[model samples]
Target chain A: MFVTPGYAQETAPAEGELQTEIVHEEGHGEAGFPPFDTSTYPSQLLWLAITFGLFYLFLQKVVLPRIGNILEVRRDRIAHDLDQAARNKEEADAAVAAYEQELADARAKAHGIAQTAQDAAKADAEAERKSVEADLERKLVEAERRIATVREAAMKDVGTIAEETAGAIVEALIDRKPDDAAVAAAVGQVR
Target chain B: MAEDPIHQFQISRLIPIEIGGLDFSFTNSSLFMVATVVTAGAFLYLTTSSRGLVPSRTQSVSEMSYEFVANMLRDATGPQGMRFFPLVFSLFMFILVANMFGMVPYFFTVTSHLIVTFALAMIVMLTLVGYGLKTHGARFFKLFVPHGVPGVLVPLVASIEVISFLSRPISLSVRLFANMLAGHITLKVFAGFVTTLSGLGAFGVIGAVLPLLLTIAITGLEFLVSFLQAYVFAVLTCMYLNDAVHPEH
Candidate 1:
């Protein structure tokens, strides 16, 4: 594909101007190094533009988006999973804390119950001991009063019995009723 | 039968189409360009068509390529350069596949041509210059004027910087073109030696083994060169595009 007859002549191997001009160029001597061959440039440029354009369009429209989406989705999934795990750990910690608090509350309630029972038992035992002591003291006082009354009664009877015994002795010995006033005076003097 | 090491670089017209005054012929170069696109496109399309969340072996290749270029661009130019990913990716795949195609016997290597690589390089430069001027305007000139230089040497430094900036396309294009051209030529020469030696009888065949081994080793090296050149091109493109966005420090 020749751009111009002159341009084509440059690469056609020492023909036309090149044949007439100074023994032709060194690299351009024989078949001409093809890369330097200017005639083929137009086609190469055109096809490169076309193919490269198509390739750029295809990649921009299709492949990149797909691959980018996959990576993005995976990153998002991983982040979400990590967040979920953190939340789960926090919730588990909260549950453990709640369980510990309930156990502490139960322990405190049991201690209070035991303290109230011990206080109540101590009060009951104190009341029972006081009542029993009061009952014993009352019985001892009543017994002491009964004994005093009996002793007084016995002392009062002793004068009468002494008078009676003296009269009986006088009556039995002298066959007569001796004077009660005399016996009483004599017992009083002896007491 | 063809023994000329340089002969492999010849261009032949396939479907010669002359429209108006221009020759728009489909050629061996063009055929391989189309082949490069088709091969790359079909591979990506077919592999990713499944859209598996967990990729298979083939699917991983498609993803790896996409990520490789994507990361390379992002790293060079930050997120601002992401917009040019399509252009960079296309260039990479096209060059890489074209180079590989050259390795297949009888297939033309498109990247070996100066015009092809120069045109691609020109595209990158044009985009860089165009975007830089449009976005940064006169401030884009800051790219040539590095900071911390003594005021007296500013002009000298800037001239050097300007010359370097202007030569970016030349260096970039020539790098790919030369590597492909030289590697193919060297491989051809070694292969030619193998054939020429084998024709000299039993002792010749024995001697041919060394060259034949050299050809195989060169072929392996050529494959590495192919991939490396493509990668280098893409990386340089990113750095240039980065210049467009950021302009200077």
Candidate 2:
């Protein structure tokens, strides 16, 4: 499989006869491709210079500039994208920070208002409790004073009744002028 | 036309002497090779020397070549492969200069010969294998056995992969050598036709005109082929180099 039929046949013709001669004689020589001739050094060098110079000029003048322009455009595009991305990222971060700050500020303001309201409620409650307690104490003192006055008035009436009974008993005893036993019984009954 | 094709391979000597074993015979082929190196060197040096923000014409060319290979390597092997830029760039320039130099009237296309291209291919293959081994150590041998294969088929798959891997140099060298050789040979054949027919006089002259036109067309095509072959060579080198750098693929 490694042996290529075409090349193998071409290499050694039957019985050592040159196969290349037949092919060469078949009008292919005039239109034949000659191998590279290395005989002339100076001419070859001169031509090499000419070719190299031509290509160098082409690259230096035409192709390179076009490619360079493309590269520059690409570089500029990449840089622009990076810059835009950075700007966007910064804007996003700023927005987030601003939101956080606003949230914190709002929280602090709400806390202040709530604290003030709570303090006011506490003070009002304390004042209401003190006034109610003071009113209860005053009512209790006034009731105690009325009870003392009523007790004194009842005591005076009782004392007057006792004196009238004693006077009646004495008149009965003097008018009768009775015996000692009778007087003693009358006095006892009156007492 | 000498019957032996080897005679054509000679380049004229600017300085001639037969020293002992040194045999530093500078021929036309050597001269062109030297000139190509110098020109390539100068071209790169001049273009890349300044490296300004706004590049000069030469600088622009140099930068473009650099970026072209850079982009290609990056695309093929990812950004990690960027470090191999120098090797890929050098290979591209050398093959390109060698190819374009061959397009001249009487210069040797070094790439047309198997030895030159084979050497390049060997280098690429060796680099690939060496890097793979270095990166993965003993496990580099695992590259021959792809993933997800059944245990039973492991041996067959490994053998096939190994065979194909071994054939890398052959394919790489042959691709370049064959293209350059065929294109040059075709050009020569057409030129021969124009010369031989032109000798046939008036009516033959009209017949010869067709070949001349064909030759002109072929010459233009040859120029295109020269560039294409160079591009193919460079691209393939990049691909192989990609495997070297990132052998998992």
Candidate 3:
């Protein structure tokens, strides 16, 4: 049957060749169609088998392995990078936490130091006030004592002068001094 | 003389050689097939040669293609389907390159031929059968007998299942071949219209504009189809392999 088809195709196309050329019509009835022609089947099949087999081998051995390796390596590298990034992020977070803790501690210590200085200044002010008040009180008392001594001295002098003036007056008027007791009695009476 | 669109697909013997009554002549199809292999190989090799952790643009493309097929296999057949990565990946890359290469001005599309695509489909089918038998032994037959079928209707269901199973290779191969052939043919026909219409004067030139735009649009779409068809082929291969891995369903 295959042989018959091949022979028939060859003869039929030969007969129709003249008319087909005249019309410039291609594949109108020549062997029906080239793809359907059985004459070329064996050769085409043979070559396809041979070429496909070799191509398959090339792919399996050389191309696929190389591609697989590259892809695998790339995957592994990406995973490794992601893991490293995660670790670095954790380290950065820890550092930030430590820095914040130190900042808080320093602030607390500074606050404590400020509180101590303020208390010291307040105590010093209180001690200075008390000392100043005591000094003022001592000075006031000494001035009062001095005034009393001066008053006593002035009273004694005034008494002596009064006695002398009275005696002078009596001598001028009567040419004689009176007795102390009499004079004292008379002055007392006049008073 | 108008260039023939179908002439792009013709297979002429570049170096005719016969051995033991077999035609082993190296044709344009063979040339492009080798070119596909080399192009795919060089692309993969050069892109991944650096193996940078941070990939270049080409490396990213290479890696994306790898992961795309890898994910497809894993999703369809689970982790156990990874063993067929080489087969599925090679088939995907080969078909993808061949389809895209055909979009160039004068490149031959190897996947457009039934024999080539059928051979690839047969390989996938045979692999499924071989692996299923090897792994599951006699229990692999359970695939044809699906779960939750009525006992009375078991024979009918099983026969349908068997026929569908047998048709997998045909369907898979035909899907790729037909899509490529139809798309290439459509593109060629539109392009021919552009050339033929433009040759006839002012009115014909204006008429050619629509076909020219269509050709451009189709070329862009064909690029998408080129990639998508390869993806479909690989995914189907993975699904078929799932049966080998888990033969119960």
Best by DockQ: 1
Residues A1-191, model 1: lDDT tens digits: 11233234344543543333212244354436678877677888999999998888998899888878877877788899999999999999999999999999999999999999999999999999999999999999999999999999998998789888888988999998878888789778988
Off-target runs (Cα >4 Å) in candidate 2 are: A1-191, B2-8, B11-24
The TM-score-based order of candidates, best leading, equals 1, 3, 2
Give the least accurate 10-residue stretch of model 1 chain A, judged by summed lDDT: A1-10
State the lDDT of candidate 3 residue by residue for B114-138, as single tens digits.
Answer: 8899999999999999999998999
Residue A4 CA displacement from its true place in model 3, Å: 22
DockQ of 3: 0.23
| Residue A133 error, candidate 2, Å | 53
DockQ for all models: 0.37, 0.03, 0.23
In terms of lDDT, the poorest run of 10 residues in model 3 chain B is B1-10
Model 2, residue A135: C-alpha shift (Å):
52
Better of 1 and 2 by TM-score: 1
lDDT of 1 at A118: 100
Best by TM-score: 1
Q: What is the lDDT of candidate 2?
A: 0.65
Query: Candidate 3 docking category?
Result: incorrect
lDDT comparison, 2 vs 3, better candidate: 3
Q: Residue B225: error of model 2 in Å? A: 1.7
Model 3 TM-score, 2 decimals: 0.76
* Tens digit of per-residue lDDT, candidate 1, span B1-249: 255555577777788877786667898889989999999999988998888878889998988998999999999999988989888998888888988998899889999999999999999999999999999999999999998899999999999999999999999999999999889878877887789899999999999999999999999999999999999999999999999999977
